[model samples]
Target: MRAHYRGWEEGDGPLLAAVTVLGRTGPQVHFDGIPLIGRPVTAVETDITRHVTDNNLGLRFASRGDLGLYGLGVWVRSARVGDTSVSEARIGAEEWEEE
Candidate 1:
């Protein structure tokens, strides 16, 4: 799925925003997409560690994954868009690397 979020904040020359994505599955899945704040979206595929029981999937920045409590996944990325930011996230059950 492609997800996008937009909002503006006042007061600052440099724009900043944070984006998070989560996914869980029993089989191999790829959490890929461009989490950005501008046009010409770039696709970024995240390497997800597949869990055994319940297939818990988790993602974090510079942190140990598989820390989610309920099979929930979390990935945080920042976009320097100057106050307003948008995200284009896509999730699929197929291998995105092969595509």
Candidate 2:
């Protein structure tokens, strides 16, 4: 896992983010203690809804990945899963190789 602040807009200042290219999976992300999931990663979302609304309003997600617990006992429905996908995060840096 890695963090990358993919730049910002004119007034956006410094950015913050991460990226990890898995063996078979594409990119895996990680955060400090936990990430910020607004809503929930559910099968009920449509292409019209953006990630911001679904991954920043609930129990959020767990920085724990791969074998880590994915908000198992959490209340938020958006972060009750564990897999290799573009999960949302809030603060902190990611854990991964330098190159």
Candidate 3:
């Protein structure tokens, strides 16, 4: 599954956000097209990471098909637009799910 968040606006400068994920050990997490966690050989239950971008933030997760009963939970810890703190923005929260 893939989750993309775009909350930055004009003159926002740089936005920084943090997210926590709860899932099985097999899921891979990526931020801004870069691998952040979920190494193939390591197993972990949760991941807390941060990302900074000017206008767009991208989050992606990948797992093997054979892993049955797949589930993932994402929590927005905090978000900042420039120097102002803003509420968590989930414009297309449901878009993360597969059709």
Q: Output the number of the lDDT-best candidate.
A: 2
Task: List candidate 3 segments past 4 Å from native.
Answer: 1-24, 38-99
**Per-residue lDDT of 3-57 in model 1, one digit per residue for the tens?**
3333445554332232233222112223333222222222232222333233554
Error of 1 at 89 (Å): 8.3
The candidate with the higher lDDT, 1 or 3, is 3
Q: Give the TM-score of candidate 2.
A: 0.19
Error of 2 at 83 (Å): 14
The whole-model C-alpha lDDT of candidate 3 against the native structure comes to 0.31
Residue-by-residue lDDT tens digits, candidate 2, 6-99: 5566998766644333323323332322332332334213211243345653233344422212232221112323453233322334332122
Minimal lDDT window, size 10, model 2 = 68-77
Per-model lDDT: 0.29, 0.32, 0.31
In candidate 3, what residue range of length 10 has the lowest lDDT sum? 64-73
Clashing residue pairs found in predicted model 3: none
User: Per-residue lDDT tens digits of candidate 3, residues 1-99?
Assistant: 224444577887434332333222314454335333333221111222233223344344434211111123332222334554322211223334321
TM-score (all chains, Cα) for each model: 0.20, 0.19, 0.19
